[model samples]
Target: MLLLEGTFPFVAGGVSSWVNQIIRGFPEVRFGAIFLGSRPEDYGDMRYALPDNLVHLEATYLYEPQDNPPVMPVHAAPETMPMVECVHKLFETDMKHPDCAELFAGLMDEAGPDGKVSHEVFLYSPESWEFIKKSYRSRCTDPSFVDYFWTVRHMHTPFWRLREVAVRCPQARIYHAVSTGYAGILGVLLKHRNKRPFILSEHGIYVKERKIDLYQAQWLKDNRSVFERDPSRVSYFRQLWIRFFEHLGYVTYQAADDIVALYEANRQRQLLDGAPMERTSNIPNGIDIQRFAPLRAQRSALPPPVLCLIGRVVPIKDIKTFIRAMRTVTNHLPEAEAWIAGPEDESPEYANECRELAHQLGLGDKVKFLGFQKLTELLPKVGLVVLSSISEALPLVILEGYAAGVPTLSTDVGSCRQLVFGLPGEDEAIGASGQVVRIADPEALGQAALALLTNPQAWQHASEAAVKRVEKYYSQDMMFERYGALYEKNFKWQA
Candidate 1:
């Protein structure tokens, strides 16, 4: 069974694509899926068809209300404060506590029919009220207790919702979570319930990204009463949210039998965040060279001076920087075109902002917004593929670009630097296949793109290096074999 949060059928991002690839890659093994999303209204139609091997699929929205909270009050657990203290200590006390796993296990035992804690006791009882007030009085720096009251409720309300769905999940030999937030919590919860193997595959560190979002979040209620506050320090509520996720991540890390990351950097970060060293390993993202080899044969000897940025048109992709970079590219080669190809539905306002920037830069006909093009049709046409994302893991686009005989130019985020220059030894010996520039640097990005697009010799060398590097190290067959072995080792199932 796979527990995926905010990805798969409803969303169209890099992680969703990877999930589809993994499911389709292993045809011999039947699979089950559990999808968790923040709210029901955020998603629309399913983006991809269900794979044939998928036997069960359950989707539950965390924020949607199925029914009102029970009106009758129930007796509170006498020992609830210990579990409550264990959770709150993550924020109030030291984060790197040695017995966190034991504290987490104690917290885990406070669920379901047999557990000491109950939803009624947590939501409405006097013990819960005293705990909330005590936490606020001791820790809340802001003036508004009303906001603090709601923040505490909002932070923890998902536990019950997640537990409800987790208990119903179909029995499977092993459970895998793509990331370590809600999905991780479910994986841990399910493992506790069934005594099954739980595997965690982190494409991006969930806590770090959540911190980034929480810092910039406009929706979070801030200093409504107290206006004069230091701007540098994070708000109490924001810190609360971050700490809550941190606790969840640590708990999941402890429960996971094995943890996998796309690169070494993330694997190390997992250790820093309390993942056991013995359980963690790196398995790079891969693609099928044969699938795109035909596209390579179809491409012209010299790729046209066209660039494509294939991803969602969101702030994280930093499309504005790409549009600004285009201003520089068009200043030299007037015919050079850039295709911003991906879903704009994820963030329409951000998409509009990008279009407006393009217009302001006077890239009228020089830039085109091609929403969701067939990769085979589009990869062969562009001279180069670019990613201006402020954040990423191991981007599949770079590997895909390589397989299609096109080089990539990416911002130095995630594994892009390691990928371009290579990881070390045999991988580095494959040589630099592309350019890596600083995040949000338009000038450097523009120059790199122009160098590859305008110079035929340089572009040819990059294209050759790209194909060689992907074939040497990152390919779909390689990924399939590794994952198959992992699944077999855990389940001892012969395919």
Candidate 2:
């Protein structure tokens, strides 16, 4: 069973693409998809179509409360008091403790191999809750222990309910997690309940990505008073989210049998967060290389002095830098044209800013915002592609550029150097497809863009090198083969 949270079939993002790829790659596996959403209403008009091999589709929303009444708060009963206390104690200490596993094992209800549901065993003993409340009060810096107790209850009461639901679900030999947020945590609980292996695949660092979004989020601001008074100057709710994500990382790392990341950078982060290095694998993002391969045949016809940048019209993409670079490039090559191709509707504010920058630089006519273009239709006519992102991780746009024999001018961040220019391969003079400059440096970016426009020989060499690199390393077949090996190894399947 694959547990997806607010991505996969519902959302359109890097993680969603990876999920679609994996399922399509292995049609033999009977996958039961368990989708977790923020609200029940959020499920409306989801576009992804399920494959034939997807035998079961189960949906659960995390933000929506469970139907059953709050079952008398686990602390109310004397008989179950000690079990609750033990769980509380386990939650207090760091997850790395050897004793934590014992506490987890105690709460599990052992199901026989015959697939029979066994008698319930209390894993979270009452004693666990008492110790947890005590620890919460002491470490939490709360003046009143009673207040801390309810705070913990209020925060994790839903999680406890989720755990209850997970332990009672139908059987699956393996549990697959899409992201390491709530769904990843559910994967941990499901593994514990079923005594089955869990596999966690991450397209993006869920905790880090979510932290970035939540740090800039506006909704969580209101809950600041309930949790703490001005806890960690950067939003109390943000800290709470960070802590929750940290706990999620701990649980998922501990429970998952195989943890896979999309790139080496992400894999390293996972290892630093306590995932065993031996269990981690880096399967870089792949594209339909063949679709762009035909562009190679038309490379000779591509318009010279044409520079194109394709991506979402957002602040992170930093289109202003590209526009500023065009101002300099236009000064050098009067015939040169710069095209910005992407959806303007994504971030109207950023789009407006870029438009203003273009006019302010007096290159408004020179630069064209060809909004939301199909790259295949546009790439054949473009000579160079630029990625002006301040932050990125193996952007698919770069790969698309590579396959089209279009060299990239990218900021040096998140595998950009590695992708465009792999480590010097046997003294080949540092196989650089294009230039990598520091982020937000318009002059340097302009110089790089200008140099490529004037020097036809250099541009030709870069394009050829890019094509060679894409064919050698970044092909879709290579990614599929690597992932197939990992899945088979973990699933214990024979050819």
Candidate 3:
């Protein structure tokens, strides 16, 4: 079973594509897929087609409002106070505390078959009220209890909802979670309840990304004025949300049977975040070389002086930075044109800002917005692909660019460096496939693009290096075989 959190179908990204690729890889093996999203309204139409091997598919939104309203006021259980206190202590203190896991186990039972602290008891018991008020008086720095009340409730509802989902999830030999958040917790619950082997493949470190989002989120209610408060003090509510995700990651880390990362760096991060090193390993993302090689035939000897950033135009992608880099590129090479190619619907506001920024920079005809073009179409025209993302995992676009006989100029993030320079062996000996620039640097990114585009000798070296590197080291055949090996070793399957 695949325990996907906001990836596949509803969203289009590297992780989503990777999930689709994995399912398609194992044609003989029947598979189950579970997709979990934050809210019902967060997604649109499915972005991917379901694989033939996918036999069971279920999707749940964590924020789906209960039809019955909040578990209503009801008779109190005697253990409610202790249960409430346990909940507070788990969040209030260190998550690694031995008691925290034990207490969470009780919460599983309480939220599960054991009725000591029923949902009603948690929602309406007098003991529950006392614990909330006590925790408020002691730890809450937020001025309004009203905001605090809703924040705590919002932070916790998904966890209970996920447990409910776990109860109904069909049996599967292995539970593989793409990222560690709600789906990770569901994996933990399934492992605890059904003793199913849980595999966690983290394409991006979930909690680290959550922290970045929470830190910038303006939706959080901050009572203090910008000038009045010290910069050291983050809004209590933002901190609360960050801690909640951190807690989920810790618990999931403890429960996972095996942990996987896209690169060695992320694998080490899993270790630092408490994943047992013994159970963790790196699985580099691979591409289908033939799928993109045909595009190379259409490539012009002198490809257009156009650079494309193929991803969502969101803050983490730093689209504005890419636009600024285009301004610099076009100024130097007047014929240069650029395309920001991906879905903008994910963040229309950010997309609008990027579009506006492009015009504001006077990149009128030189820059275009190409929404979700197939790689075959885009790869043939563009001289180089660019990734200005402030963050990434192992970006498939870089590998895809290589397979298409085009090189990428990317921010030195995630596994881009390893992919470009190759992995310190025969692969590295193949030579640098592309240029790696410092993050958010328009000047450096622009210069790198101009250098490769203006000089055919340099561009050919990079392009040849790219195709050679991808064919030798990164391919779908390798990824599929590696995952098949993992499944074979871990589960007795009817293939």
Best by TM-score: 1
Per-residue lDDT of candidate 2, residues 1-495 (tens digit): 888887667655445656777677778877788888777765555547888887887777766754533334232234344554555555655667655544554443322212111111222335545555656655654355555555555555446445655866677877888778778877877877667778888766777777767776766543335556653476434565677777667667777788988778889989887687877888887878888989778766433788888876777688998898888788888888889887576458779988988999888888899875777888888878888886777777778888988888898877788876785563144377887989988889889987876787888888878888777777778888887787677677321
Give model 3's TM-score versus the native structure.
Answer: 0.95
Off by over 4 Å in 3: 68-72, 87-94, 97-105, 112-114, 225-228, 492-495
Tell me, by lDDT, which candidate is best: 1
- Candidate 2 displacement at residue 302 in angstroms: 5.9
- Order candidates by lDDT, high to low: 1, 3, 2
TM-score ranking, high to low: 1, 3, 2
Instruction: Give the C-alpha miss distance for residue 89 in model 2, angstroms.
Output: 5.7
Task: Encode model 1's per-residue lDDT on 87-120: one tens digit a residue.
Answer: 6676357656766654665575575655666676
Q: Estimate every model's Cα lDDT from 0 to 1.
A: 0.86, 0.72, 0.84
Regions of model 1 farther than 4 Å from truth: 90-109, 113-115, 224-228, 492-495
Q: What is the lDDT of residue 469 in candidate 2?
A: 79
The window of 10 residues in a row where model 3 has the poorest summed lDDT is 67-76
